[model samples]
Target: MTKKFYTVSARYWSTLDSVEIVQDGEKSAKFNASVITAPAEYSFHCQLVGTDDLYPAKLIPNDDEAEKWDVLISSFQIQGFNIENNQFSYASDCTSFFTPGIWMGLVTSIILLWILTYGIHMIMQLTTNSRFDDPKGPALSVPQTE
Candidate 1:
């Protein structure tokens, strides 16, 4: 089977406020549920490009009745901070706090590599002058000798 690629994949986190079951005149929904976190949740929902079988219909908590509703603590991601009910925070530059030496070592190694490459190039030019020709340029005037 071939795997399809998604152009966008995003994660959302929200605490559901409530769930409810609404009964019409005759028909009823067994697996009916509404999702509620906060107003920010909708903005994240708006970014979703595709849909499962049950979408385009907003899932909201049934704020009227209480007995007919069931809350499922499934690990589904939602959009925005549910800070009215929970806390999710983010901060930048965490790597500097944890591993400063790793970044510094990477920079030092890159500089050392450039110096070694230049030295090797000069050594090769001096050793392989079998044709006995002195190329004219500022490079030749550098006077590199043992």
Candidate 2:
């Protein structure tokens, strides 16, 4: 399997601080922040912390993977907050096989469908005393009795 890395960043302002400013209809302060998250080996955990303006206060790379870093900075403005100067780093495992249980289920479903279609064909043949023929082929002839 191949692994891919992605970094997510955003700029925003929070209303937590300066309640008076918010009460007076003043815009919240803007700041820039980023977080780096990677898939855990034999475990999956992503921590996101919320601050007055930035979310996921800090980003820490997983120790097992290389120190490849990807930086993503938010360009759009959200409410009264502005984000800038953000960096992100992460890693993922790209090699893994589908679980046996899922594969078995899929195979079982296909087999069941084949069996059902075959059973229907057999029933039609028995009832009509004729082989199931394709509509695209020549039509069958009916015997005439005196």
Candidate 3:
């Protein structure tokens, strides 16, 4: 009987989110999240890539080594917020509140304020026009009859 061995290679990449790896196998590795923060006006995504193959032989043999080789891949997305030492740590979901929500709220408030001011101005203008006469226009005159 011949002893067979296999090798595995894994890589993970993310734009704004974090990744946590959990393995219950003989070979395992740990990785850190990317440093890029989420965008203020849009949502972002994360990606993972993993590859595995049999060792020694460049191509996997169908004879017996194929049956011995096994690959397991697992991934998880972490969410929520944490604050420590006066520093803030935000996950993908948590960061969204600061980015999209804040800007949306700001824009909505500004639009509402403009609409309210315009409505008030229109009302005041109507009242003034009804109460006062135009000073620059000619007055009404009647011809005197003999």
Higher TM-score: candidate 1 or 2?
A: 1
lDDT of each: 0.40, 0.36, 0.39
Per-candidate RMSD, Å: 16.0, 17.5, 15.9
Clash count, candidate 3:
0
Clashing pairs in 2: 1-94, 1-95, 2-94, 11-83
Query: Which parts of model 2 are misplaced by more than 4 Å?
Result: 1-91, 94-97, 128-146
lDDT of 1: 0.40
Residue 84 error for model 3, in Å?
A: 12
Please write out the lDDT profile of model 1 over residues 1-146, one tens digit for every residue: 11223344343433334333446765333333233232333322222211233343234433334324433333334444433446433311111243568878988999999999999998887754434436773444334573
After superposing candidate 1 on the true structure, give the runs of residues whose Cα lies further than 4 Å from its correct spot.
Answer: 1-8, 13-98, 128-146
RMSD over all Cα atoms, model 3: 15.9
Q: 5-116, model 3: which lDDT tens digit per residue?
A: 2233132222423233335654333322344333332222223222233211112223342334443323323222232555334333322346677899999999999999
Which stretches in model 3 have alpha-carbon errors above 4 Å?
1-25, 34-102, 127-146
* TM-score to native of every candidate shown: 0.26, 0.26, 0.29
Question: Poorest 10 consecutive residues of model 2 by lDDT?
Answer: 13-22
User: What's the C-alpha lDDT at position 136 in model 1?
Assistant: 70
